[model samples]
Target: MKTLLETLGFLALVQGAMGLLHEFTDWHVGLVQRVGLLDGHEVYASVALIVLAIALFAAAERCEAD
Candidate 1:
């Protein structure tokens, strides 16, 4: 469970950062922009992802080691 949370948190952080990066610069990377549903909501999604990552990290920190 700890390892899973950490992995998910790391992935979320990366994807969120990538989304924001793609939005600000000409790098044009990440799945956020490619989603048809997101459209102009890429930034929001990115921010949400970052928030999720933070929460996941917190949860992982609280988890007991097996």
Candidate 2:
């Protein structure tokens, strides 16, 4: 459970960073730009993802693996 949360947190961090990078530069990477639902709100979604990742990590730390 911890490992899963950590992995998810890492992925979210990477995606969020990549989204910001792509928006500010010509990187052309990350999944943010590929979502039709996001449209012009990728940055906000990326930030939200980062926040969710943090919460997930905290929850993981408080959980007891079976």
Candidate 3:
């Protein structure tokens, strides 16, 4: 259980970081533009959701452990 929690925490951190980069930098947008979906606001919203989900999952895991 401890290992599972730790792994989840790490995954959450990685996902959150990716989301942050996507939202705050142009690098991700450039990539998205190349993929031809750049005009869609849904992509950005999904990234935001990923960040929020990771944060909430991590928090929940910690609380459960405690």
Candidate 4:
């Protein structure tokens, strides 16, 4: 479970980075653009995903310490 959480966190972090890139840079990914979150606020969705990634990482660390 800990490993799974860590993997998920890592994936989310990557996704958030992609989203940020898609939003700020000329590079655009259709998948991230189609999220339809916050009425097309990709930045919000990306930030949310980043927050989730952090939480998942923290949870994984806590599990390991237990």
The digit string of per-residue lDDT tens for model 1 on 1-66 reads 999999999999999999999999958888899999999999999999999999999999989642
Off by over 4 Å in 4: 37-39
TM-score of candidate 4 on Cα atoms, chains taken together: 0.86
TM-score attained by model 2: 0.86
Q: What total of clashing residue pairs does each candidate reach?
A: 0, 0, 0, 0
lDDT of 2: 0.87
Off by over 4 Å in 2: 64-66
Expressed as tens digits, the lDDT of each residue in 1-66 for candidate 3 is: 656655665665555455456656745633333434545564564465466656667766786879
* Local accuracy of candidate 4 as per-residue lDDT tens digits, 29-60: 53566665555788888888899999999999
Model 3 steric clash pairs: none
The candidate 1 region of ten consecutive residues with least summed lDDT is: 57-66
lDDT of each: 0.94, 0.87, 0.56, 0.84
Higher-lDDT candidate of 3 and 4 = 4
- Candidate 4 yields a Cα-based lDDT of 0.84
> Residue 37 deviation, candidate 3, in Å?
15
Each candidate structure's TM-score, on Cα atoms with residue i matched to residue i, is: 0.93, 0.86, 0.43, 0.86
Flag the better candidate by lDDT, 2 or 3. Answer: 2
lDDT order, best first, reads 1, 2, 4, 3
